[model samples]
Target chain A: MTVKLYRYLEDAAGRWPDKIAVQEVDGSFITYRELDRLSDRMRDRLVELGIRPGDRVGFWIRKSIDAVATIFGVLKAGAAYVPMDPTAPPTRNNYILADCGVAVIVIENRFEPMLIAEPSAQGAYPAILVIGGAGGGVHLRAMLDEKDRHAEAPSAVSAPVRPEDLAFVLYTSGSTGRPKGVQLSHLNAVSFVEWCAEIFALLPTDRFSSHAPFHFDLSVFDIFSAAKHGGTLVLIGEEVGKQPLELAHLIADLEITIWYSAPSILSLMAQFGELESRNFSSLRFVLFAGEVFPVAHLRSLVKYWPHPRYFNLYGPTETNVCTFYEVPTPIPEDRTEPMPIGKVCSHLEGILIDADGRAVEKGTEGELCIRGSGVTRGYWNLPEQSRKCFVEVAGATYYRTGDIAKEEPSGNLRYLGRSDRMIKKRGFRVELGEIEVCLYRHTGVREAAVVALADDTLGMRVHAHVVSKDGRTLSLIEMKTFCSEHIPIYMIPDRFSFHPSLPKTSTDKVDYQTLKFWSGG
Target chain B: MTHESSAMSIVKEFILDEFLPGEEPSRLTPTTALVSTGILDSLATLKLVTFLEQTFDIQVKAHEADEEHLNTLHTICELVDSKR
Candidate 1:
């Protein structure tokens, strides 16, 4: 089996040239043959521009066929694709670009607003290849059109890239600092994809619906896992997500066989009663991750599309996937509690370590650590940070997931809570300290402490406890508006509660645990 | 006034009960913002369309699933009645 992401596509193209590889929401479909040809053209263009293996190429575009092409094309050119969400705040985008040190960025002309909004992007990259057309001041599609498609592909692309060589750098949040890029090798991704295909029993006839954005790790399973089995990958637009009725219609219209997304989407669907309305006869598998799946939510889902096998996936972007549990038995009628993350996936070993870093006994809570091919190499450009999380054990390495979990008597793993202060809201990792820093940056704010408010509707909403100077009152809407300019929509605190002074621990650090209770859970 | 009768009323009641399971009796008005009030998320909006189509036996088109028809309880009930 090919270790590279592009190689998987090429293998599929050779095996099923005429088969549909990806179908977009606009009814535009691309065959495996077309995908290979287009990818080759992009690769030729990248090579002509002097981009070689080991060079970082940022795919800063919205979800579309073009984004997928950039990922495959980057891999084909022996380069690593760093996906940057177009909707991300300009500062965050700058942080990622600066941290990753990418010389070039592949973006859509429509998304040039990010470049226009950020003054730092003026000279951020040496070259910015706009996908569609010439937006402002950047290289246009002429570069792609002028490429010699007939030219032989680079045989000696990068030094025979080992499974340990960095494949892609996925940027994820740290508890008290800027997002760090996780360096995952081709071997790490390939192994995870292989296991994913097997666990789901994916068939060539399966049409996997893609909803998660490119930056998110969940989308990796949708793209690579489908390509691995020569299955069809359907790209659903953000509009489909914004309008769930359209999403329901698309599932039936596109004949989507495999469905995987965050639990929020499914919970929302179950809330609206859309699951019971349509005949999703084509769907065979459904998986949810990035958060704890509420039992009541999953039950509502099964009530409609009961035929598909339901699965709860657990892992961090640092490790593509470590454990998953298929809902083998039907959920009980009175399931008020959340479902467990269940067992580890095949080809991986999981251990729960307690506070003292010793293996915990069965049924005892501890930090979940994983050792396998799926564990990423380390964080890119952050050696000091990388050494902190990735630790050597018996001469081998394991990634500390920072998630608290417990091992059942039957060896199944149950997710408890986060060992760190980091929180997952609507699948986007938010650093409470980072939010606090943003709050402190406000001119009117003297000091701040951000806390999470538990709401069943929108997952976890942020509430900032602040002490403003001169007793000036700050409105929640005004603070949210200010945060919107500095952070992504998901990171914006839903509520702001003013305080005289933050409650501090003995060591003078903000008492987050006490503040969590003060935020009314 | 097509849905003013007992038979149609039960359908509306069922729609409210299934969609807003734990909603208060006092809040089950003819018009309530289901989409805006955190009652429906992206998936719930889709599931609502399918649920209406199956329960009312009408194929709801993708484009028609916009806020005009599915945003509010009254609008959804009206759309279902018209389609039926």
Candidate 2:
């Protein structure tokens, strides 16, 4: 199989040359032909900069036509792309760059600060490549100007990447207190896309709106599925993301047929009353994942747009999407609790395993393990951590998703919670250890334990209970500002409290449950 | 800003009916703190913004609806009036 993500895009161009492949909030449209031409030019420029086959490149740009073009261009140049969210802290961004050992860094000038905040690229890479300006290393705009826009797609490299070759690395937080890069291969991703398109009944006329960033795995479904079937992809601007009303208008005005995003985002839309009087006549599918969807909110959405089929997609980034369950029809009266995660997808196999690594019988709870085409290869550059989760079963590897779940007699999977201390906030993985490390780095902090607090206002907020060293007092503002430098802004504690000492268990381990009680969560 | 006209009553009812759900619309006032006061949380804020935009036929740019504008019912009413 070809290792290029662009093959799908190229096919779309052939099938729909005049169709709008992407539409920006500024009203600028990138037709398939233009996307092909621009990506060709960008590929040539990357080649000119010594980017070779198997080299890892990166993209830190916002959601735009350039982002879509650059993703295809990197694959066209035989390089895998790593993405950095611009909203994330500079330190986290720096760590990902160093860990991936990315050969080339491709980012717009506006986001240059995120890359340069650290001393240097500490991994197996060279200089950064700046787009839209100069002064970093190679000026992408200048290189593009010098390249041939009409250049033909480069011939397949002599060593064409196999289906198992790494296609991209997505860095996510782990329970071990560090970010791990999940290595997804071409086969792993394209297979998931094929399964999704088939199961969802995607068609060429489907106009999909992308709310998640390119870095998020959910974007894979949007981009790959759209490109595979020559479907229209309407790119929502950052401005639209902050204002739910603007996003609703974009969806309604564009006549989007499929909507896929985090449950929190959808809840925001429903809570805003945007779903009350709006008409989404063309919408036929609404897919949500990343966090649990409250059943009440789901009912409200169905009330307004009853035509669209609603599906709760459940999976970790390591396995793109292994399980899905459509909400029951005739809407049950007792759906106030979180909905069930349901059975495995058509191409995946799932089972619940207890602490002894033995399969638990029906109605028994255990960690959910999945084996499927969508399961990622493993973490990049961390063999030990990879070995811990990806276990060989029946001569194939199965990933331990760490989500505690139970298999009912009906084979439906119901979620229990995390087996570890990690939590999900705003759809980003968060580890208590990561927050504690940030707290320890502060000057006046002697010891700290970060606990997640459930707040009705914000789903979940991190609360840090700290003990000042030598009677030193640290103000909330100071601790917040200090944490801003060490960790991503989202992982920082929203509310801080100073404690003399933390409650400990009999084994001397930090009693997080007692901390949770103290937190009033 | 008196809840005198039936149009004002309708808008008030829409806010209470949609956001507060079963609560009486008469209890809600134009000066009420729809968001911070627990009347409307983040999700309700989204619904309120959408309600205002569609009912008034106006586009609410993302940045314009910051904390100051969305925090209270009076502020939201002021924002809607300005947009109108």
Candidate 3:
């Protein structure tokens, strides 16, 4: 086995040089050999740009063959890639760039204005490498063209990447209103990839759909597992992923064998899309994670597209994927119970522990703690926050996943809810406190509280209740406009309610339970 | 109100009720850019699309869901009018 992550691409190229490795919905395709060569040229360019081992590179490009090549090139150059959502608010992307101190950023022409507009005051902004179109930054195409003109193959001086070296830093919302970057090592990512490749029985003939964006950890499995197994990876763009009927058609047209995404997306497709009328003959495996799968929707999907094997995976961005549950044959038609998160993946051990660090009895719910090679190092640059989650227990390090779960007698794990106020809204993990902070940042707002309301479609919907200072009032449009400038759109509350004064506990803290009850959430 | 005005009213009401409850309807004009102003995200846009289809009895093609056609209230009204 290779120690570095990019070695999968190299090995795949050697084996299936002419095989189509990745294809976009618009019919653009990249063969294994072409992918390998492009990434090699990109790696050479990075070396020439003085990117050393351990340097952080940022990727804010759209989902394309070039984006994939850039990611592999960054990994090959022995640098960690920080992927920011291109559609995300530029302020949020700039915050991540400043936070990680990225040495360079790979971007497309469309996103140039967004990045150029938000100049980092902290001096952490890196040099930009434009993928297409004429831009002010270093044109990536020109660099590759220059390399091609030389007629000499770049030296094969590969960066010496070890298994323990950092592979990527994925930023997620922090409870403290700022985003925290989770540092994952090559070993951490590879262990999860190899386990998935084995568990799913992937083959070179299998065509996998990359439904999740690069920023989401789910995409790690989509991109790498396909590369590792030499399977064809179909890149599903954001626009197509949103259009349910279109996505359904593409799934059939491309003959995607492995389908992986958040359960909510699949549920949306089933609800709005003509899923029941469509033919999904080529699909063999359907995997979902990030949120609970509503049993009713799952049943409908199983009935509609009957060929695929169903699975429910559960994990946090901190740990790529620690637990997985395979849907049993003949799903109960009337079953209403929440599906079990099931067993831990190989080489990982999870325990339910109480607040005082004591193990909970079977059938009792407690915070889930995972300890193994899959556990990430910790949050980047936030030592205090890192210490709060990653702790030494019994001389072994364990990541305290804020989720509460109960251990079944059959050794399966049942997810309860978050021990903290963190909730998953539209398959994106959001901290209510973070939204409240954004709300309070407005001058007209005096007090604010954010809560998650359970929704049948969206895993959860955010609702914000506020008490204005004096007689001042703020409209929802104004509040949303203010928030859009500060936070990502997904974090914005779905509904807003105003109160004269917020209820408080005896301790003077905002009484959230009372708010939840009064609001009927 | 005529059919176009009623359709516009319904669209504005839905946006306000879901995204900005209790806000004045006048704040959102016929030219307000829902998509550009960050009011309708991917999921929210889908919800709006569903509402248009069910309420107006119009089919919203996947290609017509872009900002050019569905971003502003004017374009949305135009789309509904054209489909109807």
**What's the CA error at residue A158 for candidate 1, in Å?**
8.6
Models sorted by lDDT, best on top: 3, 2, 1
lDDT of 3 by residue, A1-521 (tens): 67689999999999999999988887878899988887888888787777889998998887878788888989999999999887677888988987888888877767777785234456544777766732211245565786568754455566899998999999988888988999999999998998897798899999999999988999999989999999999999876786777888899889999999988888878776788666789898999999888888887788788778989999999997899999975678889886999988996888888888777888999989998877898999998888899656677778999999998999999999998999876567788998998899998899999888777777777778998887556776778778877887778887678889899999999999988887786
List the TM values for chain B, per candidate: 0.72, 0.72, 0.92
- Misplaced by over 4 Å in model 1 are A116-125, A133-143, A146-160, B1-84
- Each prediction's Cα RMSD? 7.4, 7.6, 3.1
Best by lDDT: 3
lDDT of 2 by residue, A409-475 (tens): 7778998999887777767678888889777877788889988965543557678888899764465
Error of 2 at A498 (Å): 2.1
**How do the residues B1-84 of candidate 1 rate in per-residue lDDT, one tens digit apiece?**
444454346545765565544444555555655444334444456667767677668988767676567755667767776776
Worst 10 residues of 1 chain A by lDDT: A133-142
TM-score of each candidate structure, all chains considered together: 0.83, 0.83, 0.93
Residue-by-residue lDDT tens digits, candidate 1, A116-211: 322233454446777664221113334465333445434334235566666788887765547778888888899899888777778889999898
Q: Which stretches of model 2 miss by more than 4 angstroms?
A: A1-4, A117-127, A133-143, A146-159, A394-396, A453-457, A470-473, B1-63, B66-84
**Model 3 agreement with the true structure over B1-84: per-residue lDDT tens digits:** 898889888988888788555678887888766775567866778888889999999998977876778887889999999997
**Model 1, residue B1: C-alpha shift (Å):** 30
Clash count for each candidate, listed in order shown: 12, 6, 0
